[model samples]
Target: MTTIGIDDMALATAHHVVDLADLAAAAGVDPAKYRVGLGQDRFAFPAPDEDVVTMGAAAALPIVERHGAAGIRTLLFATESGVDQSKSAGLFVHGLLGLPPQMRVVELKQACYGGTAALQAAIGIVSRNPSERVLVVASDVARYELDSPGEPTQGAGAVAMLVAADPRLVEIEPVSGLSSAHVDDFWRPNDSSTAVVDGALSMSAYLSALTSAWDDFAAHGGAGIDEIDRFAFHQPFTKMARKALRRLATHTGAALDDVLQEATFAYNRELGNTYAASLYAGIAALLDGDDDLADRRIGLFSYGSGAVGELFTGVVRPGYDRVLRPGAVPDALAARVPLGLAEYRALHAVQHPSDVDLTTPSVTKAPFRFAGLRGRARQYERTA
Candidate 1:
């Protein structure tokens, strides 16, 4: 059987970034509390003309431009920060990419796990139809009430992947370890703009889910505790991922050493939490930080609050280094302009404007951007 996996991948984050130290100063808290305790350097947020749709499109447009839209038959958009309840978010991206009209597009929701769900589904689709290629895009804008416990973790970003046979990047194994249960560790009500979180409860639940998923994976012929060379995890906060690895080591009694790299999550610490795109963005950061990963086994863990968890494995393809675009993440990060506390507060309010007629001249510099709301219908445009 031919192998199937990620062929090409790309990532996009908000155009504006706010330094955590600035936020800490405004809150009258020690900057170290957020920088060290949370292991976050900065938090990302969209510009006035940006959102999940625009960010998602920006990440995916490169793939379509390179691979063309010929064999692409379906698009799976995974997002918790959906702009609409009824329509699929991928449709807007499909239009932006100018893909063929006869295509399948749908939005997935399961908190952060929605991205992993979309990936698994895409792999299954390719198995049934080898000729078809699937576009998987995970995008989100995590929000929290001002000064709330979850506010420091707020972020926005997206990841786009091209999944097909004989991929140039990595080949995903079919097996996965999964754990799901009804839990209210974190939740967002339909009427509210921000999420409600039980911080301590969430941490405890996360540890439990990690061990359960690892055990199931071991039982299902997955790699042993320390067998995989590198690991990528869904990080709501960078420090939580560190907590997970330590817990996994204790659970399996394995001395899983030297599998992590400073580069693996360097960008993530700056991004805070991107919800659905967190794990994939970590993978990009890992690849961006290192080369020489050919034929190396990698472990991936996905978790979503409300909540679902999965542990899967993929092996780096031969000559994977040559195809990867290094410095992409760093380049994007360097391009962003910093937002002052007052500017951030103003933009946050503008994002949730009460008026629907938000039509105005587009000010965003991204390739794709939200062109404000026209009679409650969200409009988008291409700037370049």
Candidate 2:
């Protein structure tokens, strides 16, 4: 067996999440639509200068620095939020992290499912070449203009996972998934800033794709939801995760409500939905909230619209807490500066780069920043 291990995982999100209450009052939306229906209490908004590359680097730094470079041989970045169509975000991150120059690097794109795909691919590559290790990152910003129907769920962030032959985190199991082509949910046409999603239709597709993938996984592992210790779904919204769980509950003889008792509003409630990083964020939340998670088997479901989905499982290893970045989660989230409605709208309206001076001094942002936009490109600089 080609055993794969996850050495460490890290998450980082945009500092600004306009209050849902503020949004509801401004847009005349019932607060429950976001609070109960979507299970979101806060939603992140991307700064004018921030892009996926910077977010990806921020997410991975804590984990990579903790691991200390020795065996990481590849850097795989999965994102839909690329700044340049021609350049790979991995290259930018590799240079920023000062990774060894000899490492293999590539970028993967599949909407939100991009990150998990990178993780799976890295596992396979390392499994075949046991001496080699891979670094996989999934980062993106979900944008839908302020006060739009999709506004309540907007978020930005990234997660980085270092995969090796022997990981200190969860072990990636050989699993199956489904991919389908659909124009039902996506952001296309290079001119638009927001994604157009058929919300109800996308929900159906998530369930449909999960059904197909789980059928294949059941055939291979003979383990169903009843056998797994936890289920982490792509957190597009709190409600969507619950819906997917109910779909899985039907076959695995698990209670949808019971399976998601802790997941409901406890984790992503404040974080909103992070595109590629959503599932990983959920994993982090669960790990932090539960003390008895060791040795538990977790079912991870990831979906991206335009649209693809997967159902996979991993076993939480002993000492998962010790291996993970300590206190990073609470610190990152708490460090954010909450935006007022006007401040959020202004920030969200900041256009993508043009051939202009986008680089500014890092006096306003501490630790992380979009740095500046210049020459139609974004420069992400880390403050010392």
Candidate 3:
């Protein structure tokens, strides 16, 4: 197999935010219950003009600008927050980013694991056709019932990657540890826009899948806990990843440090859970926040509710630090307009009509936005 992996990555989130403190105060709960207990400070929320399509396009635009879209022959979009069941979300992104028409456009879904599945597929495509490039974009808006236990965990974002031979960011090893089983951890029916979650069972499933994948990886002569330099995990709440590391430490007899969790999952806390995009967002945070990752090994575990898991590793490219746009993630995060409890609640509550022309104003300042629904078709546009 030829070497293949991410050449570049970009992160984008909804421009609206709500402090977890605001959420707690509105719910008549202690602020620390969210700030410290859930390990989230603030979370990004979509404006009426933003959704997974717009976010995914915004994230991928930078990658195309740097690498050029000519070599990209595959576009894999991973998401749980899909706009339409019949149409692949990749089609909207293809036009938005102006990728070539000859590409294979696909939309993948399996909850959070969708990102990993898209990435693996991209790797396979590039490995077969080393001269071609693949664009893998994972985006989602994690929504739950208002005033529910999962409310604070809700978030919106996207992570876009350019995959090709001799990648600048990292080189993915062909081997992976995998596990899957049916579990009533989380799901959303076609009739509803929100998820139904068994929080306790979901967390248990995540840990169990990680353990199984880790053991399988070890059995296949993968790295031991001591051999790995850092880790990235699918974080629904940032605290859950800390718990996962603790479990690994106990299982492998490794002495782990507390700072490691902060390094790996701090983005999840800031951005909240992004569903299919969650794990890749963690990886983006690791790559963006840390500078000493050059030539270091990164072990990653991905778990999706209902439930599938995989453990894989990648080696950071030499001079990988130079490939990223410095201060981009932080700048995008800082630029978010803070929302009051009422504004936030009202924004989440508004439902645009899909069967007719939409009257919602185009309000997002992002490069790409959902213009409206026109003639029962979702419409998106590039902003000036």
lDDT of each residue in 177-290, candidate 2, tens digit only: 555657476654567767777777777778888887788777776466677777888988878887888888786666756555474245477777777888888887777777
Give the distance in Å from residue 29's predicted Cα in candidate 2 to where it truly belongs.
Answer: 3.5
TM-score, per-candidate, Cα-based? 0.97, 0.93, 0.97
- TM-score, model 2 to reference: 0.93
Q: Give the per-residue lDDT digits (tens) of candidate 1, residues 1-384.
A: 889999999988899999999999999999999988998989888888888999999999989989999889999999989988898889999888888998999999998999999999999999999899999999999988888888889998999999999899889997799899888999888877778899998888778888889889989999876679988888998888888888887888877656765566787887879999999988888777777688888889999987799999999888788878877878888888899999888877654554557765576678988887777777888887
Locate the minimum summed-lDDT window of 10 residues in model 2: 359-368
The lDDT for every candidate, in the order shown, is 0.87, 0.76, 0.89
Cα RMSDs, all models:
1.3, 2.1, 1.3
User: What clash pairs does model 3 have?
Assistant: none
Q: What's the TM for model 1? A: 0.97
Please give, for residues 1-384, the per-residue lDDT of candidate 3 as tens digits: 578998898999998998999889889999999988988999999988899999999999988988797878889999999999889998999998877788889999999999999999999888888999999999999999999999999999999999999999989987799999999999999978889999999999998998899899999989777778888889898988888888888777888763264666767888999988888888888887888888888888899999999999998999898887778988899999999999988888887656779855777899988888778998888887
Per-model clash counts, in order, read 0, 2, 0
